[model samples]
Target: MPVPAPTLAAPGESTTPVLAAATDVTKSFGRAKALNGLSLSINAGEAVGLLGPNGAGKSTLISLLCGLRRPDAGSVEMFGRNPLDPKSRLQLGITPQATSVPQTLKLRETVDFVAAHYPEPTPTAELLVRFGLADMADKQCGALSGGQQRRLLVALALVGRPRLVVLDEPTTGLDVDARETLWQQLRDYRSQGGTLLITSHYLEEIQALASRVVVVDRGTVIADGSVDDIRSHVAISKVTLEARCRRRPSTLGRTRSARPLRAPERPPWSPRTPTRRCAGWSATASNSAASKSTPPPSRKPSWHSPAIRKPPRP
Candidate 1:
């Protein structure tokens, strides 16, 4: 069935212009539904982050917003027109999750090709230099490293100086320095009034770049708000104490028994602190055999871990 157009802005909402929107959109592939009544909006001059776990419908939603795929139900709009309309996409740019480029074309030629499509494209020289691709302008696309190719893809997205840009995992394979460079460039882009919709597995990346975060799960939005608001709503409270103790102190084992401890390193050593109890807590040596055999609990944070350990409020 044909979907109806979305209203310009919801009642009692901020009047900022909405550059793109998905209204109660749904999509399905065979028996697996990718989206279920999911709705989102991107306002002008805003940097929004889309976050979700694998198979949470984020990619499907992006496809709908970019006109790469039509939704099974509901509507998607870009610049107040149907996204499938070519005219509506002229001011939009996108970097898909998978990266590919013409193997036979030199980096410069590729940039020139994409720029030619826009009436007022950004200068090729400036785009290359800003993305650190100037030195490799003559290199063929096939000869570029994965990181370089990723950077080139991003640079191409901006070649047209788009009003709205959508990036998916923009820094996936980049090292720390290169990641920082891209972050700074994105910040500068937002400062200049360009709107952004970014999806990244890196929570820190989202925190660093987006003023608003949208979290999706079960094919729908579960949370949406500012970074701090999201954090405060879903974050787990963690408290740590620094104490020097020789060997695995009985008190330390008791503390671990009281509550889980996610320590990264072995506890420090000090003979006098074996039974040490800090000011706020009490530590008593237990003679129970189970206490003697208790091991210190430890965990290390990794990129693959959940963005927030605590469960979301109902």
Candidate 2:
């Protein structure tokens, strides 16, 4: 399937203006460079997936976007204001990779405590019900399961009713059911025109929630597009072969096939060799005694061993 093209507008210019932007961002810790000239702009009402392997500077970028940490170079803006400014963060929410709620506080109390800081906040009861935490509302935070706590943490981020939300591995330790529930909640948020910037290692999580995907590798944005475009961009051809053992005549070595199983249609000009099939054979010496033998041929040669020979189709 083809991916739709992106609609772009400068910050605060169009009807749906850019809600957040990181321009030429650079950050370093000690001797390690976490981010290098990274730039990303997110518009209103969009769910963008930030994907990368470990040590890709994804977490660092998130911190800069949320104003938790300033960039070493360049600048970031939230709602057209500097991210470091309190006014810029008034409409922002974030769920960090790890969070610790007061052990003595009940779930409702914790929600209320967080809600008190915002001018307009979602009601604690309604928020708890939306996050499937109504039953545990009166339970102490320390008594909740890891999955339940994770759900509450995400719920807390939304309690302030921020226009833009950043979730860093929100479902990291969640079970399949809980993860799906959270995905549904995120989808519901998007339906109401809320923007999301999420970083996750799970490709399925990104596929389920993001309309756009940004692939980062070695602190660089390598690919950016819809799911199909990213998939097609990274797709490659693979060859499969069957190799036969020389010593163990009856025992065959079954190697795993190559990846990306999808194959394109044969070109019109290509000729088909209907009878040809792949066969592999490796030479081995059984004796430790040195034998006066010549080196193998330098050119590619055909395989002639009987062990690797297959009978012709009848």
TM-score of each: 0.74, 0.72
Whole-model alpha-carbon lDDT for candidate 1: 0.69
> Can you write out model 2's per-residue Cα lDDT over 1-314, one digit (the tens) per residue?
11122333322334667899988888999889899888888888777889766678999998888778989998889999988887898888888898677899999999999998789999999999998999999999999999998999899889889989999999987876787678878877777778888998655566667778887766667678765555444331111112122333332221221211111222122223211111111111101012122223321121222222222223
Q: TM-score of predicted model 2?
A: 0.72
Residue 121 lDDT, candidate 1, scale 0-100: 96
- At residue 77, candidate 1 shows an lDDT of 99
The window of 10 residues in a row where model 1 has the poorest summed lDDT is 279-288
lDDT score at residue 225, model 1, on the 0-100 scale: 79
What lDDT does each candidate get?
Answer: 0.69, 0.68
> Which of the numbered candidates is closest to the native, going by highest lDDT?
1
What's model 2's lDDT at 188?
79
| Number of clashing residue pairs, candidate 2 | 0
Q: Enumerate residue pairs that collide in model 1.
A: 245-269, 245-270, 246-270
